[model samples]
Target: MVYENGKAWEKIVKWFGYKLHLIVDATYELPIMYSLTKASESDIKEGHRMLERMEEKQAEILKRAETMVANRGYDDTKLIIKCWDKYRIKPVNDIRNLWRDGEKTRLLTNYKNVAYNYKGNVYCYCPETGT
Candidate 1:
């Protein structure tokens, strides 16, 4: 697995372990599915793979899911697009903050007050967008 899976994230952490990823039904609060992978894995890829598994193993529940929420770690454009395109499930993954010279900053500085909302409706809030 090391040759195909492990990746050197940095110098100190010689990671050769696995990570557990899971998804749950928001309403029922029951676990839906889980996956284990090498620690050097990408969360976005794992997320999609988990959904694909759900499509095969739990098609009924997967079909009914309207929205999916995840942290910034799972933030990927392709994942977001695929969630809607393949399953009609909206992805509400938190976006990482943009940076300026290694300093964290909002993506759109002009709209300082414009907040990004992922609670249910996945979109940014602005007067023009009718938020």
Candidate 2:
């Protein structure tokens, strides 16, 4: 689990009606990993701190794996993120209606510059037309 600003707090309020956060580290497959849970305290209030915690866990796991595979000179590891959503949450009707109207414009404007450059390159490379 990862916490983003007040998102976790909001989730706690919405779900369990609490306002706390927790950071948990555990060993899985002989390596350490971490997760976040919201409660009544603020364990991670900033994104950067949460990122640091993640990096710390990753480094610990890497060091442990390296030590275990010292003789082989190589090791393989995989990290996974698992999320559990209990409530069937949906956007409000008004928001959904407004989103349907504005989504295309938002998406188009967001990608317009990138798409223009790509299309320019495509047309520049036309073999028959010799653009």
Candidate 3:
């Protein structure tokens, strides 16, 4: 089978290979489940797929699990909500810097006393030394 496998650019090296997504237990730090896909496959989608696979392959573990902690890559509202509404698992994913606690913009390009939210909201500051 031929597919459009993705490319990865890391630092100064550019290469083409598959992406491996792994899920591990928080305490034991051991592998739980994993899936390989094209480099272009998104982290959130792959992560969700891994979760669904767990539902079938490891129902016992899923039943005892309470939260799925993920990095900012899976910091999607819809996915988080779905994890809660569908599986009753709380997604403890961290939002990107754009949504950092009461912080500024995503890019923070040449702007001061100005902050932007993920949902297209803007915050204005008085510039009075952390106001």
Candidate 4:
């Protein structure tokens, strides 16, 4: 797998933030997976590159496994391979505190305060829109 990150490890340490790129193959009962750290690179920049690298690596692994399986020829066993991608981001802020009642949910607390929330509210001014 390929890991992509800018030179922002210091910021990540200070703010308790992390970014990850993960791939999983779950077709079989015993899943196979790979993951890598991506500190602060944009998804658009790293997405395609990471996927391509993972595909190549997974193909090699599968070929090796296939050869082994053919040699052994295990009985009544199935080999199903799957590949998928995942990404995660954590901003350095307590979102629960930003809420009205400040009641933290189980998902929020479990994720180390790193989950997106969409309560019943709307914002007229969106920073991304610059409106």
Candidate 5:
């Protein structure tokens, strides 16, 4: 039994097994890479491992990749930076709301009337109305 903590909703899940992590091409619906890890492993960790392995075993695929889309489970800053800085691939992972004190939607810059939410959705507020 694993007690998942530090989440908005916590629960004790009765699970004991391995998990299959797959890097799939969304357009073609094909599998690019795969690995099996213990259930306790984190999605971010597995994502990093898969990218590292791809660099060594399948550099061509990584070079041709444009974006890495993933679920909220893999919403990690280090992993996102790794994909962009090393491989130049834009990460489109769903983000978790990690803001404190119930904050939401921060201004992108003081000069611009643009703001973005935790999920990376940009909003352009009207300067006159400030909506």
Candidate 6:
């Protein structure tokens, strides 16, 4: 797997090795926390563990955070809800298109005009244009 963020790129090719999950303060461009795990470990699982650890030990830092930025690898529904409901921190993570059956957009419940794409981007359908 290749984790690409603009100019910085991290490639995970080795089968038998350790993976380092590091959380950084983006404003300062400094690392705040880290976790080392086996290469087989899932990013979502590690992400939950990291959040738990932060809540238990360094909650002050978590409280200061307004948003948590992550890649699609960490785009689990539960994790996203947890970040918002528990800490009130908005998650700015990339979403993966998990839609099967060639779904393009899903209409929002209770809102006739509003619909969202697989990426969670909301849009309004025009009745006149039939769009």
TM-score of 5: 0.66
lDDT of 5 by residue, 1-131 (tens): 33466446446667599989999988999999999988888999999999999999999999999999898989999999999999999998888878886868888767579988877788999999988
Which lDDT tens digits does candidate 2 get at residues 59-98? 4533333111111111111111101121111111111122
Q: List the residue pairs that clash in candidate 5.
A: none
Q: In candidate 1, which residue pairs clash?
A: none
lDDT tens string, model 3, 1-131? 33457655445545578888887888888888888888766888887788788889998887777888888988877789878987888888777666447744553467777777775677777778666
Candidate 5 stretches with Cα past 4 Å from truth are 1-15, 99-117, 120-131
Task: Rank the models by TM-score, top first.
Answer: 6, 5, 1, 3, 4, 2
For model 6, how does the per-residue alpha-carbon lDDT over 1-131 read when each residue is reduced to its tens digit? Answer: 34465465656576798989999999999999999999988999999999999999999999999999998989999999999999998999998889986989998998888899987789998867868
Query: Scored by CA lDDT, what does every candidate get?
Result: 0.78, 0.30, 0.78, 0.36, 0.89, 0.91
Q: Candidate 1 overall Cα lDDT vs. reference? A: 0.78
TM-score of each: 0.65, 0.21, 0.61, 0.27, 0.66, 0.67
Clashing pairs in 6: none
For lDDT, the strongest prediction is 6
Off by over 4 Å in 2: 1-14, 17-32, 39-47, 60-101, 106-131
Please provide, for model 1 over 29-115, each residue's C-alpha lDDT reduced to its tens digit, 9 standing for 90 to 100.
888898889999888889888888899999999899999999998888888898899889998877875443563223355664444
* lDDT score, candidate 4, position 60: 63
